[model samples]
Target: MPRIGVLIDNNTLDDHLAREHGLSLVILLDSGDRWLWDTGQSGIFFDNARAMGIDLAQLSGLALSHGHYDHTGGLDRLWRETDFTGPIYGHPAVMTGRYACSCCSPPRAIGLRTVNRQRLASQLIPVSDTARLGPGLTMVTNITRQAGNFEPIQGFYLDPLGRTTDTIPDDTALVLETGYGPVLILGCCHSGLENTCDHIAVNLGINRFHALIGGLHLKSAKPNHIEETLQTITRFGFSEVYAGHCTGTHAISSLSDALPGKIHPMGSGLLLTFPPSGHSTT
Candidate 1:
């Protein structure tokens, strides 16, 4: 069986849980593949890993879903503190400035501060399409929005002055080809969860996701958007979903109703397991 650990997120339930101001995940593949999905904004990678009992030296690789500070904030610490020597995966745009719209104007530069930028460059691999991180595990690099009704979540806007762009396409996910099915792990899914899954299906040349983990970015979804997402999930036939981080209570409830016990809430210290060939029994 493969093990997955939540290294960082927005909320921790107890001494056994950790909730911070950002999101990060540690993925353990059945093939002995290990990775740090996203790093939180605290930049306390060592402390967090020790607290969670995750040995940083054991990681096979490090991947960033995007360049957002919340997603890549620990880069400097990881590079400066740990002995981890691995390629960091993400789109090239991660190196560019990011911004959000404000007051109906072009937007403001919301990219990570200058110091962090230099550190990220030192560790970036900038993958495309699919990068096989290890046996049976591939990173889906491009996520597209095919549904017309699926709008980019609000509060995200690009600066027209050329200072910075949303550059969210840089956001990505991970796919593990376990015995049960392709276990999909995402960062923010800022590019849209459906889009990410669709890319995975096409890239891996298979349908039927065994597990869905990570942020769905449905915090401010509209009625139509929610309905569309529900319909899409039903059509896609995901067996299980563990969603959180920017996902609202209403959205979680809706997904729970649609997916029943298959729907679960993920937070810091929450541990999910999956047999090498099937869904996790416990």
Candidate 2:
């Protein structure tokens, strides 16, 4: 069996923990393989981990979803506050600068900050394509847009001046091979969940997934976009999707209403067990 712990998210599973507009997850396999997914927007992940009795330092390795602040903000804290000195995994573009420019507000740097870029560069192990981490775990990247803009991206730039568009090529996911099927975990599927699913199916030869977890990045999605996502999940037979963080309120309501108990909220303090206790929304 395997379990996934929610270290940071936009909401808390209960009143005892805190909430933030970010995301982090800890993956614990029965084989003693522990992996930290993301770091959230601050050192809050550390406090939450301590409260939940999880040791972030005692992990095999770290895999990043992308270069966003919300996903990698705690890197500096992890460097200064913990004994974690393992390898950091992600696409090479994950360290590139990212910004947002829209409406009247000036373009703002939204990529990883507070952490020393040079220090991270020294530790980052680029996973440009799917890399097998263990017997049943794989780091998935190089996501392509086979579907027609399943999630439209805008207002994001690679440079501070907002001249070049940032397609978030570094966005990645983790795949866990299981008896039932493969499980897809994401950091913020910027390439679009539909695209990510399609990539795995076409490239990795995985069709049906046992479960789906992580942020969908649909905070500001339109109704049709949500419907498209619903169809995507149905198309892939993803029975349980623990979505949170950037998944947003409107999208959550729509997804939950459409899928009933199949759609569950993921946040801090939540522990989802699998391989028999697969759908325990605890």
TM-score of each predicted structure versus truth: 0.87, 0.94
- Predicted structure with the largest TM-score when compared to the true one: 2
lDDT of 2 at 149: 64
lDDT of 2 by residue, 190-239 (tens): 88888998888887787888788899988888788798899989999998
Query: Across residues 1-282, which tens digit of lDDT does each residue of candidate 1 receive?
Result: 677777777756456555766778888877677788877876654576787777887778888877777777777677667755677778877766666766667656656543655556776788877788776667777676675756454565456454443537777788876677777888777777666667666766656777887887787888777777777677677788878776677888988886787887677776677767643211
Report the alpha-carbon TM-score of model 2 versus the true structure.
Answer: 0.94
In model 2, pairs of residues that clash are none
lDDT of 1 at 253: 91
Candidate 2: give its CA RMSD in angstroms: 3.4
Candidate 1: RMSD to truth: 3.7
lDDT of 1 at 200: 66
